[model samples]
Target: MKQPLADAPASDAGRLQVPTAVLPLAFGVLGLVVAGAALALWVIPAVPRLTIIGDELVGLSYIVAGTIAWLRRPSNRIGPAITGAGITWFIGDFVFVPNAVITALAYALMWLPNLFAAFILLSYPTGRFFSPAARALFLTAVAVSAAQYAVRLFVLDATGDYGCTCRNPFAVLPNVALYDVVMLVTRIVVVLITLVTLVLIVQRWRHASPAGRRQLAPVLFAGAVGLAAFAADITAYNLTKASADAGALGVASVTGTLLVLARTAVPLGLLFGLVRTRLDRALVAQLIVQLGQAPSPERVDEVLAATLHDQTLRVIYWSPAARAYLDGRGRLVEPSAGEGRAIRLVERDGSPLAAIDHDAVLTDDPELLTSVTAALALAVDRGRLETMVRAQAEDSRSFPTGRVTLLYSDIEGSTALLDRLGPRYADLLAEQRRILRGITREHGGREIDSRADEFFAVFPMGSTPLAAAVAIQRRLRDHEWPEGATVKVRIGLHTGEPEIGDEGYVGMDVHFVARLGSAGHGGQILVSQAARDANAGELDHDDLPADFPPPRLAK
Candidate 1:
């Protein structure tokens, strides 16, 4: 059976274990249902019609905004906070109930949504309160809100003209003066906290990068408008003091409407910001193309850096054998600590393939990182394979020795060629080595040793060693030499049952082959009688030129 592509999102979805859209959808539907019920039962029946409408609308706004944010960015906490605020605001409508118990419960919980909203604002963009001052302010807001709710539930009378018509079932002592004093203190604290939050938001905005500023602009404007409207409504309500005057009522009604509408702006602004932005599809496409081209580790890093627009991005492979992270050069890599860098681990089938070290800002768009990583999964796995091959090759080089036919070759006049070509000699020397290695490998030869312009290779019995030598000589003769340099090598072959040991063929046969190569002239092949005899039937007379001499004994 054909397997599904491992990198495809559908195939990888099982790894995450949760559908991204499900939770947000569930919460959104629940919030809307609760908001609808609250509007029907509480807002329409309230005495101050405009205030009730404003409050319900603000609650609805939070629901809509929260749902959008949640659906768009399920990993972020902002969505849940806003959504919870909407649900809690709707629950606060229970205060309009005629039952004493319900009214008391509702009154106790009425301020909870505002507390949630304050927290959401303080932790905008990152969803977590990252600063000490921000955390302190959030804790203070929680305490003040809780104190106000407690005072209202236990000390104040609920059956007053203040708001609720139901009696306070939880009230212990009805102290109107004490209630007023507590309420005043709570309001003062709220005002101070609000001011501080605004200041913090401004500071964050000013210090943010251009991209960060674009994300903050909408939320900041909406928050400022909401705060201004809320303050105006509070002032207007205090001034009216339940007056029957038309002008006072009108002012209260207008301010109340504005406040409710402004409250919605907060979520609306966030939703707008999210809607306007999306992951870079072009970068993703480019990355897919680059990865498909069989990229090296360095090339993979370059592509990721270009795609993410972070020049400092690094690709580190996880070496299971070494049990450590390694860079492209096979050197151990220690990721920097507290450098505002993020490590994104890429795994295949629960086993790690590699990790990307990149800027922390990339975490904000986790989907992008995930997409790019998925695209590079195959490349990363290939890197693992290459690393393993290199490790095995190194191990082989450390202990390679076997009883087989060995061939050694050296440039006849390499020193003179280097002096003749000067700086340009290196290029010709490299080309010579490449051609020799390629021909040797093609003839079933395993390279056991290599030095500047010299090669030691082992091959199975037969004409392969002799055939490879002939091919190398012919290539050198037909090729165009550099302007002031020529490439020529002397080849020697011997058949022996030498002991394979660390540092390769170590017995007399190996030394004998080296001596045979040293005795040959440029473009000459000197094979020992044993090698010639082993490949006797396979050797072609026409393959060897008349000018070339036969095998000679190595004393």
Candidate 2:
């Protein structure tokens, strides 16, 4: 049986894993059910309309935004965590119920929504705690929340803390003074944690890469606003408790309302940050259109930098001749990122063709990086050829400048193969070039030029040219061609002093190698006596034919 293609859509396993299209619909129905329950709960208690609207707006905004984000990036945990926080918000409404047990239970967990908000803020965007300090702080916050619930259940008088008449069934010691002290301590601890978190967030922004800053901008701004409002509310509430002043109470009420509004912005900002990469696709679309102009390598670097919004971005072309990455000027360069930068590799047929070094934050969105790498493959390949030409010229300066072995190869009956295979012949020819290029580089040879169905390379006056010729013939003969096609290559090798120019080798030695290659049949490696004599000890009967005709200079 034929194997499936890598990109084929996978079959759904079961109903538990919902399709992307149905996820939003499911979440919508669930939201409606929760909303209906919340409305009924608020109505029976006769809660003020403004209070209910405020609560519902803050809660429902979380649900809607969280659901959209979750659906947009199902792989990220932030979405589901935010949705859970919204549900916790609604559950906290049970405090309004008239039943003592339910009301006490609700009061016991009243701080849970705040805990959720803290967790969301601390882990925004990536949903993972970034550092050991962040993780430690979150654990400390959890302990404080747990402590609040314990104090409410065992020691606190509900009438004093929440102004409720409900009985705390588990309150064995209802000491009002002790409860107030404990509450103040916990409140101070919570305030301290929030302040530290805000500080940490600021540090993250300051240290972030250009791409990281972009991803963190919207979410961090919203979180900072919310945290500030929360701190103001806490301080105002503390002032009202310390002094029996109407102004203090009014300030507390205003800050509380501000806190609610600020919290609503949190989810919206998170949603925007999560989908920012999708928005960046618009730039990539523009990049595709711009690439149609077939811009030069420097022009491509500029276009990509603008497209990705990273001024430090670079595009380095792969040079098969030098077997290394090179800049447009043909100078060898390292492709790995340093410090605040990141690198994305470009490949064709599983071979590394080029690489892009940009802001480290670009890796945060693999889809965007992958799209950019894929979009530039053809353009990078085009640039590689130009780079290779420069690389060969630059490399030749270091050559012996005396005698060198030249190897020329051509595919036998390539025109007939093109006639038979048409467009598919291009793939065959490319595979041929890839094989010969790799073999040449492997034997310490530098590729001089490659044109359709032909390749020319030079090696130091040694056995490498003969070795490369043998490997080339062996590789093509053993390769499995598509549609049972047959490919045979003829190779020619000669050792002589050629007129070296910036354009490449010239004169009689270059012409002799070409004519020498045509004198051989398919799968034959013709070697002039000069190349064999230069490396007389290295050649063996097993590696090359025992007989060779005299040198042929004329075509």
Candidate 3:
């Protein structure tokens, strides 16, 4: 089994497996969040004209569920989530509820503590209790929410519009009523809290570590979304505008969804990431092989990435006594002995994706296990190759290279030919790129970059460059091109310098080679100055451009 490195903590469960309870909880939370969002939009404008109804009840259920889960197991994740959701919903509910109306103080009473708790949940890291900064933020929320709640309570007896967004159901009360005083304080405090949160997280990206920042990034994204929604909500409240309501509601719904993604999805993504560490070499290799055989590369990557992130007992191959590949800031990773176990839990942050820990005897020989891991690595590498190829193709119509020969297999007089053969022939020209890439690896070269009418390859370094080039030549020679078209390619050859890097990128070498190849007559291999040099003054080229210098490569 691939063992997790030290520094990464062992998961409570053996796999990135969520309990059955969590699925229902997830659906329920999402449903309420969405439903409430719809309701909030429907009534936010002309809101005072119509009272908030079951919306409050719907919110209460979320709060109750979260709270109940928390009470049952404070150590579990549900508590913080419940606490945050409860407070967030209250904030939403208050926007529509009339202040100085319907036991106005009752609204404040329920919402105050929830505010403090929400801040803590959002700000604090999961592993430990609260950090100093997080605690400070939490306390600040407590002070602010409490101050607003208190002000509301003290002024509850007197009532009026409060001349604020919270339109009191009892506009019958005078503006100077005691209830109005509370409304004034609440607004000031609410505005301040938002401003402070906004400021603290504005530059969070600068200092936080990747893991810390991952956690922080969502908080910041959520804050921005919240503020935007709040602004829209306030605008709707003030304009007495009907159109504003739907826009406001839509924004709120998006904000909630973003929150879910950050809160749930991010962690879930992390779990998927963890799966890579748990699996044995053979199993992971099998998975990778399956990934290669899969019809859709995107589907394979998504599934593999998910499995790596979420599975528990995620295993990482420790090279030996001390060597670690994933070197991100804040974590120095080196191998450690596992005693009887296959892997030790390692620190998290940019480690290689994990595999699952399998108890099966993966191989009788340790050497065989090593071979399996190498094969797994190669398979994953292939998936990445396909991904990069697709990405490059997306950007442009052509990519130049030097490693593999550049052959602009263009049909002669494509424009005239296109009109003659018609758009149906255009299909064949287009099919050209796809077919080339699919068979690139099979030809002992990878289609490093591609575009319309042309695809470039880098001869696989796994084989001798000469052998690899010869293989490519044969493959190109045999390829049918397009039928019933005058498309014939001029081939280029130069073993000169190519900017070779990840994803088959070749630089200047490819350009000169292609230029040479495209020169001379239409049907032959054109050898460049570099190619002649690589040949050690051996081969004679019949195809050289008129102005080009010819080499003494002919021995």
Over the stretch 351-435, how does candidate 3's per-residue lDDT look in tens digits? 4432323222221123333444444455544544554467456345333443334332333355665676565554445434433
The C-alpha RMSD in Å for every predicted model, in order, reads 15.9, 13.0, 19.9
Q: Which clashing pairs does model 2 show?
A: none
For model 1, residues 328-377, the per-residue Cα lDDT tens digits are: 54456765534566777777987876778877666776666788888778
TM-score of 1: 0.56
Candidate 1 weakest ten by summed lDDT: 240-249
The 10 consecutive residues of candidate 3 with the worst lDDT sum are 321-330
Model 2, range 1-555, lDDT digits (tens) per residue? Answer: 111123323554354357854765576557657766767775554344565566688778778877877776676667776776676666656666666777777778766777777777777676788778888999999998888788887886565333246668778899888888887888788888889989999998998867678788877888889888888877876777631111224778788778878888888787776566678887888887776555655778998887777878888766554456766544567776687777777788767788888887666566677778878986666544543463456455654468899999888898988898878787667656766766776677877887788888889865377777887776666555655677887788999999877677889999988888977778888889998887565544374344544534563
In model 1, state the lDDT of residue 100. 78
- Models sorted by TM-score, best on top: 2, 1, 3
TM-score, per-candidate, Cα-based: 0.56, 0.65, 0.36
* Runs off by more than 4 Å, candidate 3: 1-79, 82-105, 110-131, 158-186, 206-219, 228-462, 465-555
The candidate that wins on TM-score is 2
For candidate 2, the per-residue lDDT at 324 reads: 67
Alpha carbon deviation, residue 264, candidate 2 (Å): 1.0
